[model samples]
Target: MSIRLTPLGRMVVPVLVLVGLIGLNGWLSATMGRGPWLDVDKVFHLAIGIVVSWVFYYLLRQKHDAVPHYGFFGAGMMLGASGWFPLVSQGLLFSALPDWDITLFGIGSHRNPAFHSALIPFFLVIGLLHYRGMRDFAIGLSVGVCSHLLVDLCQSASSHPDWYRPNFYPIVRGMYGPFAVLWMLGNALIAAGLAYGAAGRQPALVRMEREGFE
Candidate 1:
């Protein structure tokens, strides 16, 4: 039998799943007596990934004129976005894979130009071109990585207070103080706008409400 959801359900369910995963992570961290599984920077990345993935799903569904399996698609996007843990001989590294460069090179600084560079995502998307039928997954992962870097840049700026043009590295000194906060707020606003637009354009959303997925 096929499963389907109403338009509202399509949107609500994925959000619920995101919330559930975050809650589970928090609970696990508390029970395991561990530091937060993800630091605040990483938590920002996770939130960006979930929001971007959900918006992208609606956009793709609208563009393709296809009724995607919303639940499955949403879950896949979330998984791809947040799947950064890598096992080493010592233990599992909970940070994003790109962050390994800092550890590998023994960079004591939390913000590394190489790892947190904004250019990295552009290259990642270009590299993903070799893999067909995986664009959505790649996009989700790239968004997550990029957002992580952006958050790190903000945090670094916040901590340093005097750093300017810290994001692009050697090319430009990053802005600090109010600038970082504005940058973050701008990103949040863009995401919210895209989500709203996608919701408006989803042709199949209401259909799901009536007929459900088949």
Candidate 2:
């Protein structure tokens, strides 16, 4: 699971895993319930998180040697987990991060919008991660946030009744296609933008070294 591969191979594995899992989930729902069962949201989220983390990781690694070699990596190797563990674990951990609002902040509804409303703390974490030389991990977590918000923000009030309430975020209730999709995409784009900014920044040491060279 922790094996490194050629770039093409590394990219292909996640897609394959996503496809296979989706198929398996579909099969399970078909046989177990015997009727319509489209409840593989978390699986899709997990795959999105893993795949997007890789996307950001690859982009960040292109110009920065500070980023790790994809497998058996930690923010600074402290996690010590190997293979796909680094990315996969991050994907799983951060994708569900937004849901913590339910218990921690006493939010009555699931997938509450209050989490993203607070931008100051998110910015603080970004700064701290940059200082710790873990901006790549920050990018990974951003991808997960994007994934969570993409799904949660896309649902219609008709589907998720809790969305009926007045909340911290805008509610674009629809049939889960046009308006909802566009709204979700808009939020996700901002998350992607944040990740892009993180990837574009160089570590202080790296920046100083480049200046010295120049």
Candidate 3:
């Protein structure tokens, strides 16, 4: 059965979906009794975030005045490179003989509690900038990022495995492959959305303009 949702309703649906995904990940981590499961949970969480962003954009495009904001995409790319690229490329900085195992001040400290704390602002800022003058984008990204942080906190409280420690750490090594998948999915969806916006011939935002929430 097809039931139509109001603009706000449409927006809230996706946000709720993202929340449920994050919560599920945390719960799964708790169930697994380790952090490796948490990484798997996060991969799903990131995928949900990508989907929510897509839906939010689809809804926002419905208005006549709703212009595709190329700036947000540009900003997202820059934020990824400047803030996230370094962390992802940590392996590249060291020799192949042995992985770096230093503290936050040195190698092998990438998953330190201090580093996680520092990541909050970075992710939040990127989320906010992803919105880039659009309420839906801002809301979606903010919720997604906050949910992620909560998941992290939950995992931490569970005393799960960390990235730096091996014997004590429960997480699977080199799980970044999953993150790569999520990141690639997000980028692909964003590119499609931008293309749709630019096409301008067939608008993707199918809602009525009179609703005032394009």
Candidate 4:
């Protein structure tokens, strides 16, 4: 089925993606380094971001326009935006919020809720627009958000010692300096990979298969 984007949906997806890109850029400036933000993390994030979007589009190739192009794009953008929220929020509050005063149940990263909240609505709208019911929407939302969060948690807790700081409550920390830049680079690449996987032709096909089952 040939898919098309509703005008409003078209506008929304790109705008959200652009905003997400901008936020990451700002975060790179603040956290990575002081000199013109020559951090590799930003480069990785941008590259991965594009790759994720492209890969997602690719995987859905069979469904080319099935999910409604803009709808898929919007869903992807929502995840992207949400993925960066924690970093952006922390950057914003880094100086303002005391090290000992930040928690809504002591979640380590700000990115968690920021992305998940936005993701649910994004997928919900995608479902509504496609006249697809709640199942695909929920799956998409859960997969997108949970997948991203799982990566973050894993990176933070295990593989990426340099990317984030290990601490309990009130003071969640991430690394700084060159190593920090590398950490962001790694995370961004991983995010992009997940996005690509979810949004990819295979994933989209899986979604379509699930839809058929329902």
| RMSD of candidates 1 onward, in order | 9.4, 8.3, 13.3, 11.7
* Candidate 1 structure lDDT: 0.46
At residue 62, candidate 1 shows an lDDT of 53
At residue 127, candidate 2 shows an lDDT of 74
Best by lDDT: 2
Give the deviation of candidate 1 from the true structure as CA RMSD.
9.4
**Candidate 3 lDDT, 1-214, residue by residue in tens:** 9999887987777778867866776666567633421334435535553554466456557754544454553233222212212223233331111112232246445333322222333344444433334423323333344333333434443554343343344222233433423333343344334433432422343342334544
The clash count of every prediction, one per candidate, is 11, 1, 7, 10
Candidate 4 global lDDT: 0.40
lDDT of 2 at 130: 32
- State the displacement of the C-alpha of residue 4, model 4, in Å, after optimal TM-score superposition: 25
Model 1 C-alpha lDDT per residue in residues 67-133, reported as the tens digit of each score: 3344433433343333344222121255564465555665454334444443444454455433323
For every model shown, what is its TM-score relative to the native structure? 0.48, 0.54, 0.34, 0.33
**Residues 1-214 of candidate 2: C-alpha lDDT, one tens digit per residue:** 5876898887787778756755775566466533222334444555556656666677677776565324322231111111123223223222255554544655455434445422422563367543434555555555666755654553344346554344523443322334444555665677667766655655654566567742
Best by the TM-score measure:
2
lDDT sort, best first: 2, 1, 4, 3
Model 3 score (lDDT): 0.40
The pairs that clash in candidate 4 are 3-65, 56-199, 56-200, 59-200, 59-201, 60-201, 82-115, 86-110, 86-111, 165-173
